[model samples]
Target chain A: MKKTIDTSGQACPKPVLMTKDALVENIDELVVVVDNPAAKENVSRFATKQGHTIKNIKDVGTKFEITILKGGNKEETEISAEEFNCAVLPSKGKTIFLSKNKVGEGDDELGQNLMKAFIYSLIEVKNTPSTIVFMNSAVRLCVEGAEALPNLQKLAESGVEMLVCGTCLNFFGIAEKLRVGNVSNMYDIATLLTSENTLTI
Target chain B: MEIVITFKLTHNAMKAKRKVLFDKLSAEIIPTPREISKECGFSLLFHDSTSEDVRDYLDTNELKFSKIYLRAVVEGERKYEENN
Candidate 1:
């Protein structure tokens, strides 16, 4: 009682739309095979929002088989294309605006310590932001020999994109020391801040 | 899926958190969870067992802070697990 929808190499909204149609039909069980993480998340959220139990999601390399149980009645289903559009909650990642190397103003020693605490605190959180924009004094954070550099590198390795301001680096005259992440211009920085849920620190 | 909890800049709360770590609480500063935030910073990572103790210490010391949250991780995900 299982049907597999091979959404492999298919584009967005299609994989999700296909999954929804299959699920509403009460196909005992539905398996959506998608190639990317976003597709998986979109399909998973779509299914979850519909009150359909996601029995299991098995990942094999980049391919994911999202197994969903079709236990609900079909008569009360409101599965629609419009609903699927809103099912995907604006990606789980957000943007972080680090305008200062030290967390707060005042004593330099205390400010640096506070900044350290802030980075360490970020690591201890329940959700990680998608991007961390390093500008102004914060540009020093990504330079070599920086304490926060280790953690920032780790975060970058974990799929978090670190955008260090190129102008900030040039202004500080330590652009060569920039170790982690790509040198970003104001164009990218401003776009990230406006597009995502941003937290300025 | 980790959440952020802000602490009031109080001596006792800072002292207590340090003491717990000084006493060797299995905690370390980790990158904030990407699901909730991307701002890298220091956060306390503790097992479920010591959460109550941490809460009690914060309460008794009248430390103001944000909420304690649990983060979801995919099983077998690799990340540094130590205090430094």
Candidate 2:
């Protein structure tokens, strides 16, 4: 008979812990339910490493149902389980907006320089925001040869989402030259800024 | 270990920045929100240690710009400096 463990609605470690408990009591199959992608990944990794065979992984957006078979020899290790402990860090989300080529109004030259410095500083920001939106002439800053390109690219590699306005690119006629980030529209812009505590440039 | 630097004028700072490089240099021109009480707009920000280098670079390039002023984090913790 197959045993099931419902970990939906539970936080990280709890889902992991419940899965572990089910594994100890189950013989053939253990079904684990968890909400959030991170929790699902962690739980699946942990289960597969514990000599349990992951038969299938079904994603249900906010939750997942994973079916794991018992006593399978797997190459993965036990650290996946340890990742669920109290020391397991929580994820942080961050978002920034670059409105203009420069930071403020006054000295146009200084404003541009300040913009570069601002982007550079975010590279070191702990618990960084998830995305950065660039608009107006600021969109040009992410194109090839822009001064801030290096920093913007680095942040993108680190899982930070880079969004540039499509209309802005069309306005500047440099849409094809964008070096990094995704092109988004007005609805996305509104949702992104309104959904989070955004910092505007 | 970033050094702190301040400018006497905003235009000078941007001029200093342009002569240096839009990139490469760790410094950036920010708004002089602190220096002037009047609503000007922005200023410049750079590494404190690089202030002398920035000054020398501007002088060598003979770039003319605006005045610089003082600014600090009067509110929340800022990553570098904000151009008010």
Candidate 3:
């Protein structure tokens, strides 16, 4: 006997579970329909691992029709639905928080040089941060004649948002020396710090 | 093409930077690329056109350095070849 289950529009694990339930009903042949590619792969893997034969997969418009044959193979291995993994991973915008002019502790001069290299390397990374918040002594990095000015300018030109603290710039007495980023207040900085996927340096 | 001059010590690297800038040659201090040396040290990066100017200035000022590399972008990545 043949049975068809329309799992279209349903999210992951749901389609896998529904397919498993259909197979459990002792159906000889089952056709499972899913909307997304991930769902299709998950269901196909689940059914194949259960020692069933995959007869044919048809792409009908935006959905896929996967025909699975039960008892087609002599060696049938029963597997749990949990064996199939859903491929959806949450993607968040990354942010870099610079609170100091240097990168780490130890030698102050080395730290300063390291900071220059660190900022320079940022332009070379594959996944650049969506935002860079500069505070405290780190504000010097965005100022005129700063070693890191060119790199920061390149990042800004490439659409990376640079938020330089106004208070820090004022405190440093170089507010007019700002060269590459916006003069942001504490409220905006605090919001980004609390909400985004921030990496503090 | 660009040139990167690495130093045995950070002080020499800093001194080289001051010497190059005092002469008004275009250069910046960058971390030595791992392809050159795995050690955590500094290097001076300048344009290929200024290679002679930088070499002369550093030599005249007695700024000691370890190696000079010819930095080129190959397949969208920086590859350093030892110039001397």
Candidate 4:
């Protein structure tokens, strides 16, 4: 017996919940359709953990179809259910605070290089911070002449919010050159830093 | 439509990046593609059509680089091919 479930346009936990409900029907084969990348990945991971072999995954334009074959023992199902209970970890709210254009104190050139390297490395990682707040000299990074502008633009494109200090930009006389992120005030910056899991650099 | 420029060292990559920005050329510093081997952790990426301008700038400025590649997205994966 084959069954199909459409989870398009649903958010996190919704797709997982619907998929779990479908799995209880004891269907021999299940086909799940999800529109978002996160939904597709979550559903696939959940199904694989439930001991269902993924027969194939087909991408049709903006959506995906995942075909899973059920064949694991009853014990595996119990373990999978237990795992599911602990699987949905809450999203960590991460914020990076940049107070300087350079990363470290010694050797201005080396510090600048390290700063560039750090931003490049940050974007390559799977889990990027939710926001990056730039203050002081770090505001130069979002300006026209900054070497890190390209990387900053890429980060913005990847859904990482950039918050550049407006006071810093005005102090530096580059208010018009400010690029990539929105200009923010001290009050908003403080609110974000205090309310979230922030790391200062 | 992107090109990757790998450097022999982090400093050299930073130097080339400064020069590129100084010249008002469009480029970005990105993590070196897995396909390219470099001593530096970062690489310079720009539009593929800017190959001539980049080549001239690098050569004239005597910047040290390991290789230059044209990046193409094939079947949802980024593939890099050596340009020169």
The prediction achieving the highest lDDT against the true structure is 3
Error of 4 at A47 (Å): 18
TM-score of chain A of each: 0.62, 0.59, 0.63, 0.60
Model 3: per-residue lDDT, tens digit, A1-201? 999999987866789888888887768999999998888898888787778888999999999999999863335355444566665555655899999999899988778888988888888777888999999999999999887899999999988999999999999999999999899999999999999999999
Off by over 4 Å in 3: A1-12, A21-37, A50-82, A88-94, A104-109, A125-130, A156-161, A170-183, A195-198, B22-24, B48-53
Task: Give the distance in Å from residue A107's predicted Cα in candidate 1 to where it truly belongs.
Answer: 2.6
What TM-score does each of the candidates earn? 0.49, 0.50, 0.74, 0.61
Q: What is every candidate's C-alpha DockQ against the true complex, given to 2 decimals?
A: 0.18, 0.16, 0.68, 0.31
Those runs of model 2 whose alpha carbons end farther than 4 Å from true positions after fitting are: A1-91, B1-13, B22-84
Instruction: Give the better candidate number (3 or 4) by TM-score.
Output: 3
RMSD of each: 11.7, 11.8, 4.3, 7.8
- Write candidate 4's Cα lDDT for A4-32 as tens digits: 99999776667777877787787898899
**What tens-digit string does per-residue lDDT give for candidate 2 at A23-97?**
777378888888777777778877766767789989777678999888864454344445655345555575788
Segments of candidate 1 deviating more than 4 angstroms: A1-90, B1-84
lDDT of all predictions: 0.71, 0.70, 0.86, 0.82
Q: Is candidate 3 or candidate 4 better by lDDT?
A: 3
Clashing pairs in 4: none
> Could you tell me how far off, in angstroms, the CA of residue A14 lies in candidate 3 after the best superposition?
3.8
Shift of residue A60 alpha carbon in model 4, Å: 22
Best by DockQ: 3
